[model samples]
Target: INSSIRSTYFVSKLRRISQIFYIELTPNKNLIMSVNGIYAEDSEGKFIPATQRPDGTWRKPRRVKDGYVPQEEVPLYESKGKQFAARKPQLPVGMSPEVALASRSKKSGPNVHCPIPGLVVLEDKTKKKKKKKDATVEKLANDLTQTKLDNTPPDPAKRLKNLKKKIREIESIEARLLSGELKCPEKDQLDKVARKIEILCEIKEIEKQIYWPIDTKYDFCRRL
Candidate 1:
């Protein structure tokens, strides 16, 4: 019974030693163990020695199990956004990539930042155009008012004489049309008729103004 117990103890110790040896000879670099501590491969395929702290305790090397990567082997992180593509200018059709890049660099001035090849930043001109349009309309209105003031004679008798002369001229034009003496285009005939009507309406308005002038005092009393 004592021989069997001694053999069992010896077998257990031998198994432990074999397991340790097997771990050391394993193909997995991450699981490899050394005399000091765990070993890790660096970027240059060199094995980094285990670290130690000032307290005489071993500092653990970062490992896959710890969810940590070695500093030297960490990959650079990149964003997959469209703005990332904007860094490189696009080449125009029928142009070589080299020439396109060269032209883009030349056109992109020092102050401009990341200018796209085909895009142009244009200044907004809507407000300026609206202001110019408004000024033109105002000028046209002023010119029309000034023309009306210049055309009207200051003396009422002179204005009445002018109105009568326009009526006579329109009557002669109508008589020539009835007698088939004057030839005119359809549009010109219509325009002349319209002008005659406008002149008659203006003469009637002048007569009314002269014969029936409004009394402001009477109008105020009526409003009250």
Candidate 2:
């Protein structure tokens, strides 16, 4: 009998606790419903109805439906053609479009002119300076050529020394070639041989000139 009474007491306590929990939760549920039904202010400062999304998040509403426009409504975007038309220059009264355009182009600048449509002709301002610079360079080049011609005949002693140095080099190269110490392509070897022959001929000419002094009066005759 005592166990049955204890069980009844526990069951009554559980019912009382459940009733208190329901009373406490009822006001919160009502508050959530009220908040969901509330209106929100959009960017335009206009109050619109707030909506609850399927994910339980609230979506702020706009006065107009999102991304929805009536077919009869004016488009929000301005086309390139309409923009070009709006930006086109207004012609003066009694003036042809071509005449007005030409007048405007003339007023723009003297340096910029167009003889043909779509082709701009620019005057080169540096042409005179470039011509002057070129003339000075040509004059300098001519002076250099004249100096080279005046110094064409080298001193005999210096010329002999140079020839002797070249002959020594050629002899060394020949020795290397014979001993197989220096390797060269067939074409290079042939060219070196030809050069050695020319140097020998030049040395002979120089020695002849040094041994026998040619009279300047007979020099012209020898040329003939």
Candidate 3:
């Protein structure tokens, strides 16, 4: 029984050692070769066979003596897109030279300009139209300016009186608002009137300080 147990233990140890050795020797499953043979990546993370020098001259299969590598011989880019191709010109047989020339030549239109220099010169195509002001709008603007001038008081006392009147009107509206008599009182209008009142009061104070009682040269001369 002791011999059997020892043999079984040796076998398990050998299996584990074998597994470790195999893992060390085997390549990683993730390191796979490219499907297409266009190019392969190396351990350095560079494409192999490596890209050719940029200074290399382009060549065609027609020549063999010039020592130029044929363009077809060079490997194509890995991510190369669709090949370029040009469309062939369509022409009708038995057509006159002048008719063919005319067909090729672009027709002169509103946008198209003549390519023949010193033969046909294109003038400025943009035509600006003059816009006339509406008489009604002009009259309204004039009336607005006249109304502003007429409403504005020239004297500080008159201006202050006007401001005070506007303030009283605003206060009455505010009182109505507080009493819920008026649903929506113009807060902005009230604020404007209040600001005007403050400004007028300041202007009146400044005028009072600026005007002082002093005997002038004219007054002295009149007394003499």
Best by lDDT: 2
| Model 1, span 119-186: residue lDDT tens | 43433467668878999999999999999999976876678779889788678878888898877637
How far residue 47's Cα lies from its native spot in candidate 3, in Å, is 99
Q: If scored against the real structure, what TM-score would every candidate get?
A: 0.25, 0.30, 0.21
Please list all clashing residue pairs in model 3, or write none if there are none: none
Q: How many backbone clashes does candidate 1 have?
A: 0
Clashes found in each candidate (C-alpha, N, C closer than 3 A): 0, 0, 0
Candidate 2 lDDT over 1-224, as tens digits, reads 99998997786666557644543454322211222343333344323444445553555544645443445454578899989988875764455777656657776565555575444456676975787799999999999999999989988778887988888877887888889887763776657666876776676667667865665233322332
Count clashing residue pairs in model 2.
0
Weakest 10 consecutive residues, lDDT, candidate 2?
Answer: 27-36
Shift in Å, residue 177, candidate 2: 3.6
Best by TM-score: 2
lDDT of 3 by residue, 11-89 (tens): 6667557644543454431122343423322333323232223443222212123233345556765432233222323
**Candidate 3 runs further than 4 Å off:** 1-153, 187-190, 193-200, 203-224
What's the lDDT for residue 133 in model 3? Answer: 39
Give residue 170's lDDT in candidate 3 (0 to 100). Answer: 66
Off by over 4 Å in 1: 1-153, 185-190, 213-224
